[model samples]
Target chain A: MSSKKIKAQMRVFQELENQLLIQADKLGVKDDYNPIKIKEMEYDALKNHLLSFYSERSNIEYEMQVLGTDKKEVLIKLEKLEIYIKRAERLLDMYKKYFGKVFKTQNEEKEKIEKFLTKSRISVSVGEN
Target chain B: MAYEAPTIAANLSQDKMFSAQKAAYQKLKEEVPKEKQNEGTQQMSSLVWETVEGKDGSKTYKVGMQDTVYLAAASSALAEDEVESLSKNNNLRFRDKTLQVLKNKMVKLAMDTFSHNFFVAELSKMGVGVITFQMGLLGISPAEIEKLMSKAREEKNIAVKNGLAQVASEKALFGIVTGAKIV
Candidate 1:
């Protein structure tokens, strides 16, 4: 993964995360809505993917503890976990803190997530494939 | 050395989502108990008062409060001064700032991995060092990348060589909030 390629993949991860945020916003139907708790589900799936990539457990475990198993608590957990993100420059692993977590959507759920994402505010570039 | 292709372990599961929240709700329900349930779960409202100045003269912003779950998601990124404002409260505002920063950081990393562009003026000066902190924050092993690079060199594939070289840039890898080119 040469530092360069890792860097490249890192960029991709950020883009994907942005796409997911917009998706979450739509799935829940309001920027501040919480009845569905879709955001944590989003982070959860993304985290699972990254954890599998390296077979690591500590950070994710740490997050689960902070976020608890509940959706409401997950929002609070987000704040605590975020402090760690501040040090990302020194801990490249920090990116995983944000990027990991597979939002846990599939079947009808996948359609829903996709719909939200599709309807999300997307800035399109023209004349380029 | 062993070679392990990147694999996604699972997809998002609705059962997982509902169960987690249900569990929390159940716990809260338990706190009420059978006899006192109705009285216990009743919403208890708290109000905070503040004075405000309107065009006429002086007015007030009630600054009412909820159970903290109701506010609109804080803007996903704020300047240092804004961060300071959030901090002035009893950490409630700070938590929002943290969440927003967390959100922005998440997007920034994915963007860097996909785009690999130097156009982001914020992190470029940071160079390859961005890889460690950004990747580490995600809990992904920066070491994994390092190992892959080492393996690539030993194998000496021209394609691999080129890819590895591109990753070594020292850009910040992410920022407080990814804005347009940081200009």
Candidate 2:
């Protein structure tokens, strides 16, 4: 086929990529109050989309390479999609990496503070006696 | 040039945040394989936020040792913007430079074709000379013009290809890290 036809196909992919990127960016925001269950569910869905896009783009590039077609245009579009997917995935990874640990620490600290308060109350009662 | 790196002050509160993150990362280090613990540590270190002290007895917090995934995500968004802008600017510059080089090459080729035609016609002053020189200039015959066009095509392909490859890698293209379990 002609470069023009390839470019037209690439433009369609680019639009899809941009839409996915915007969606990814929106979902990537980590809300402190968002329940872990909900966050995980949303994250899983976002990741599935990203993975699919990445896979599709890779397949296209591979096919182009195997067929010995002029791949520069397709590669450029694929690369952009890759970037969006990566950024989205990186955000998701950050959420996975620290979210559990952070909340765990917060809970641990809260328990410790509660324990200290209870012990201080008992001590005060004994002193009054 | 207008962009300054984010900074955080080395105050006690900021120190606590950094230390908390450090401790958290250290805890995470236990989960990684013994051989890969160092690599894990390096990766975790990138998450730390740096603190800087201001002259006015104040502090600024930068993207380092973040306390929560929220903070990291927020910072990552900012970093993404910065990186995107920088890459776009760089790509435009590189493209313009390449175009300029291509432009010069085309101009030189035109001048060479003109000179060759002019000189041959002036020297020979015959139908054969005129026909050969004109054919060479018009790229009609399989001759010197064909060689020049072939070289031009090769150079154009090399220079034009892989501009966006710098933005993303072939490795990254194939290896997308999805969370465990499709659900």
lDDT tens string, model 1, B73-182?
23323446644444454435433444544344433432332222334322421322333233333333434544533442333233322332232221232322231121
- The TM-scores that each candidate's chain B achieves against the reference are 0.22, 0.22
Best by lDDT: 2
Cα DockQ of the candidate 2 complex: 0.01
lDDT of 1 at A79: 61
Task: List the candidate 2 regions with Cα displacement exceeding 4 Å.
Answer: A1-34, A117-129, B1-183
- Count of clashes, each model: 77, 11
lDDT of 2 at B163: 20
lDDT tens string, model 1, A1-129? Answer: 355665575677445544434333322322542323333333333344334423333455565687665466655655644542443322444434433433433356888888999899679779866
lDDT of 2 by residue, A1-129 (tens): 355654564465445434333322222322421345334544555666677877887787787888866668877877777776766677567657667787899899999999999888843345654
Q: After the best TM-score superposition of candidate 2, give how far the Cα of residue B131 lies from its true spot, in angstroms.
A: 95
Cα shift from native, residue B156, model 1 (Å)? 27
Chain A TM-scores, candidates in order: 0.25, 0.51
